[model samples]
Target: MKIVTLDAGTLPVELIKPDYCESWVYRASTTEHELLSVLDNAEVVITNKVPLRRAVLEKLPSLRFICIAATGYDCVDIDYCRERGIAISNVPGYSTRSVSEGVIASLFALRRNFNEYVRAARTEWSDSDHFCLHKSPLKDVQDATLGIIGRGEIGGAVARLAKGLGMRVLFGERPGQSVTREGYTAFNETLRSCDVLTLHCPLTPETREIINRRTLSQMKPGAMIINTARGPLINEEDLADALISGRIGGAALDVLCKEPPAKNNKLISLPHSNLIITPHIAWASETGVNNLIKGINYNLAGYFGGKVKNSVI
Candidate 1:
């Protein structure tokens, strides 16, 4: 059986061994027009960040399975693939530990004003007056409320770490959905009450722009927001406005509407000490990448053996 990986560069180098499959073709780039020609005879296709829309899939008559390298399959046209009898599978829970660690880092960075403190520490400001530079105030995380949206493996891991730090944890309920968990609260209520809010949910139709102007208005005046999930999950412009107006204390995002946006994006220009944006590196840890590779291999083996695992559609 032929197995073609459109963007194998995203996976770890060690994971792409010849022993994993019978026949393999790897390419770093697969343009829309070139995709059909590349995978015409393949039985299985693997992709990390490439899109597999109905237009591209319709041309590949022999394609039987799709192995998405990530947990979210928004890039694929699931309904169309289902109609074509193509099986789709995705990797899940691979980045739980990596993303949980990133959330903790962003939380502490904002709470303690670490960036400002570090800058002051490196300068000669300490020689002028006090023992320690008091440019920005530090806040303690102990006894603070941590609101978690999406109670999946990543969110659960984050909650566990927060509880260990003596934080009160409150899981947010889905909109129009009742609070079923013991300590769960209404989504907006949790947003208003928590000192720090973190998002780990997938970007579905309902979850798109979950943190926007209206929701930002409901948050505590000095609440901090952390998002390592999909970019569209939070409206970028609205978030920048909230930070500028002090509606929310600060925000740390690892994803953006555009990956490596152009030079003049508003979020990049929002010159507040409170706003921090990393270039979507929350899930790029070495350990997490290795785990993702294992998931891909497992799914590939299952597909070739005529059994399906991790099917999203």
Candidate 2:
């Protein structure tokens, strides 16, 4: 069998090829223009983020199976793949622990003013009159109310961690969902009451740019926001404006609308010590990466053994 891995560079570690494979091609990345040409003769393809829409899939008659290297399979056209008899699989739950921990870490950093104090230590501490410097107000995590937007594995994990730290966790129902579930708080109510709001939902048409100006206005003044989920869930321009206007307390984002964001990205150059932006590494802990690679290998093995595992289609 012939196998091609598009965008192999996204994964820090190399993928182990199945022994039955006849040919394996690992390209760093496949641009839109080069996608069709590169995947012309492959029987199976592995992709992390390179999109495989109908236009590209229709031309590749040889393609049989696709193993998405990550949990979210939004990069592929699922309906078309099912129609074309193309099998689709994805690795899920591998990064649940890693991402949940990262969210809590970010929460502590933002709430306690870690960055501002670090800056003060180097620049302003020397001129201080007292033994300690009070550059920014520090809040205790114990009594804070945390609002989580998703009820998936990672979201549940975050809730458990927060509760252990003496926090009150509220799971928010879907936005505009008139009927709230038994254990969930109304979406709007969660917005108004939460001390810290964290997003763990998927990116869908209904959720894209969900945190716009109007929604941000509904949030409690000086409340913080954390996103370890999809980037586009929060509107970047709106977030930047809120931070600049001092309406929102702070924000820590592990994902952006555009990965490896451009120079002119609204939040890139903001001079706020309260805002923290990471290069989408919340799911990249050492254990998380190993679990992800193992999941991929398991899926590949299942495919060769005549029963595909983690099959999404």
Candidate 3:
């Protein structure tokens, strides 16, 4: 078997190789322009972030399998893979605990006013007449309603954890979906009712920028937004504007529309004290990373042995 990993650096740790395999791993990222040449002779290709769309896949006839190194397979063209008889697999639920905990952490950080007080505690406390400086309002998670979009494993896990914290959880139904389905609140109702709105939905034409100016206007003026989901789910410019205008209280994003965003991404340049942006690491707990690696190997082995796991198409 021949295996070629377009971007091995994505794993950031030692990885296991399949037994008796011809393998090549690239430390640097391979662009769409460079993908076909690098994957020319490979029977199996492994990728984390580099996209393999219809145009790229059409040229690679040797590609019998695609092993996605991460949970999301949006980077690949699912229909093209199916048409080409290429087996595709992703490592799902591997980062469920890691991401759910990260979302909870972001929730507390914003709601408890930790971001404001952390910077204030350095200077304001020294000049304070009292024991503690009142930099901002501190809200308790116990009474706050957490509205979650996307009811996947991560969302369900977050709901369970938030309920344990005494939070009122509302799972948002699909947008424009009128009939309230079982175990779901209407879409606009979730937007209108939440104290903290978090997105766990995938990115698609319908879902991209679901949080635009109009939707943000529907949310509570003080509601905080946390996106550990796909980035483009929120309109970056509109999110910055909402923070500036006090339409929303705060936001912490683990992903952006563009990774290592252009020097001019609206959210990246904002000076809002309530906004926090972490490199896309919500799903990158050390344990989660190892589990993903194991899952990738398992999927690869399974496909060759007569069954494939975690197929999106």
Candidate 4:
């Protein structure tokens, strides 16, 4: 079978070669026009973030199976693929630990005043009136309330880690829910109560811009937000405003509404010492990457063996 992998650069390392394929081709990055040529006659396609919606998939006459290299398969057009009989699979729960660990690390850095102290040590500490410069507050992670949105694999992992540090955890119910379950708090109530809030939800119409001006206004004055989930969960302009106006204390975002944000993206141009933005590397740990590779191979093997593992359709 002919196989083509588009945007292999999304993964930090090379994927294991599938021995069963008769032909294999890999592209470091594939653009819209470029994908047309690369996928023209492929029986199988492996993509990390290069979308394969109906517009792109319809032209590929030979395409049969699609193996998404990540847990989130939002890029694919599920309804069209289902109607067209294109098999789809994804790697899920592969990055649970890495993403959860990243959230925990960011929480400590933001709450414990690590960013402020690091900058202050270079200049302010040298000219301090006392032995140590203490302009920024250093707070302990323990005994704080941590509110988690979408308590799936990664969120559950975060809850376990936070509880170990003595944090009181609250799982949030859907936004605007009139009644909450026994374990879940009303979304707005969770926002008002949390010392730290982290997102692990999928991106959908109901969840897009879940954190905006109205929601930010409801949060505690100095609450922190850590987003290792999909972007668009929080509105960038609203978040920038919240950070600048001191409505929220801090934020660490691994993903953005736009990847490799434009030069003039609101968050990129905004100046805020409390806001930390990493280039979506929360799930790029070596172990996580390996798990993804294994997941893909397992799916590929299952498809050929009449089982089809980790399918979305």
Candidate 5:
């Protein structure tokens, strides 16, 4: 069996070559122009973010299985794969602990004004007459209401961690549904009540741009937004406007609409200390990376052995 891994550089950990493989090739990254030639005659392929749409997949007659290196498989065209009998597998829940921890850390950082104070320590602390140079008000995390959008593994993990810190966690209902599920708070109510709102939902047609001008208006003034989920979950331009007008307190985003976002991205140029944007590293903890590697190997071996694990097809 011929195996190829596209964008292997995205996974920092070492991947063990399967003993049952004849040809195993690894590429640091694959460009759109090079996709056809690179994947030609490959029986199996592992990809992180390189897209495998229907148009691209139609040309690859030799492609049999796709091992998505991450939990979110939005990079691939699922319907086409299903139609063509191509197997797809993704590693899920591997980053539950790492990503949930990142949310808690961001919550504390934003609510407590860590960034502003850190800047003060460097620039204004020495010159102040008082021992403590007070600037932004620091809010306590305990007894604060936390609204979680998705109740998936990572969202549940975040809720557990928040409750342990004495926070009130509300699981938001589906956006358009009027009937509130037994364990869920109404979507609008969650937005109106939460002190901090974090998104863990998948990006679908219903959820794309869920946090826009209308939803932002419902949030409590000075409420913080944290997104470790897909970037399109929030409208970037609207968020930038809200932050500028002080309608919302702050936002910490691990993923953006564009990864390695354009130099001229609106949020990238915001001069607010409250907004925190990271390069999608919320799921890159050492332990998470190791678990991902194990999951990938398990899926690969399982498929060829006739029992598929983590099968998406």
Candidate 6:
């Protein structure tokens, strides 16, 4: 079977070996026109971020399967693929640990004022004062409430870490369901009470813009927010306003509405001390990348052997 991986450079080098499949071809980049020729007779196509809409998929009649390198399949046209009998699979849980670790790091940075303190120490500002100056104050995590929006694998992992840090954990209670866990509380109550709020939920219609001006106003004063999930989950403009107006203490985001943001994005010009923005690298850890590659190989072998794993369509 012929297999073509567009944007193979996104995958770890060790994960895409010739021996992984019987016949394979890889390209670091594939343009819109180039994709038609590259996938002319391909049976399987692997992609990380390339959009596979109905218009693009209609040209690939020979394509039988799609292996999405990431868990989210928003880039693919699932309904179109299903109509054409093309199977779609995605890698999941591979980046749980990596994302959870990023949440912890961002939380610590915001709560402890690590960045401001390090800047002060490096700029000789700390040395100028006879006594150590607390330019940016730090908060103790112990006894503080940590509200988790999603209680799935990554959120649960973050909860464990919060517990280890001596912070009380509270998960959002599902509607029409009992709060079985001691740490779980009503979603709104948790939102109002949490000292730190971390989001690990997917971006669905109900969850889109979950953090808006209204919700930000409901949060405890000086509360910190961290998001390692999809960018649209929180309204970017509202978040910027909250930071500027001090509705909430601060925010650290690993994902943004636009990957690099437009040149005129207001968030880019906001004060750096109250906000931390990363270029969506929370799930790009070496270990996570390797696991994702392994998952792709497993799914491919299963498909070729008449068994399938991780099929989303």
Q: Whole-model lDDT, candidate 5?
A: 0.93
Clashing residue pairs in candidate 6 (N, C-alpha, C atoms within 3 angstroms): none
**Who is ahead in lDDT, 2 or 3?**
2
Task: Name the regions of candidate 4 deviating beyond 4 angstroms.
Answer: none
Q: Alpha carbon lDDT of residue 115, candidate 4? A: 76
Off by over 4 Å in 6: 12-14, 20-23, 31-34, 124-127, 174-183
Which pairs clash in the backbone of model 2? none
State the lDDT of candidate 2 residue by residue for 1-313, as single tens digits. 8899999899989988789889999898888889888888898999999999999999999999999999999999999999999999999999999999999999999999998999999999999999899977998899899999999999999999999999999999888897547889989999999999999999999999989999999999999999999999999999999999989999999999998899989898999989999999999999899999999899888888899899997
- Using lDDT as the measure, name the better of candidate 2 and candidate 4: 2
TM-score for candidate 2, please give it: 0.98
Of the two candidates 3 and 6, the one with more favorable TM-score, higher being better, is 3
Worst-scoring 10-residue span by lDDT in model 5: 174-183
lDDT of 1 by residue, 203-262 (tens): 899999998899999899999999998888889889888888888888888988887687
- Candidate 5: where are CA atoms >4 Å away? none
lDDT of each: 0.87, 0.93, 0.89, 0.90, 0.93, 0.84
Which residue runs does candidate 3 get wrong by more than 4 Å?
Answer: none
TM-score of each: 0.93, 0.98, 0.97, 0.97, 0.98, 0.90
Better of 1 and 5 by lDDT: 5
User: Alpha-carbon error at 44 in model 6, in Å?
Assistant: 0.7
The Cα RMSD in angstroms, rounded to one decimal, for candidate 4 relative to the true structure is 1.2
lDDT by residue (133-237, candidate 4, tens digit) is 886688789999999999889999999999999999999999978644778999988999999999999999999999999999999998999999988999988
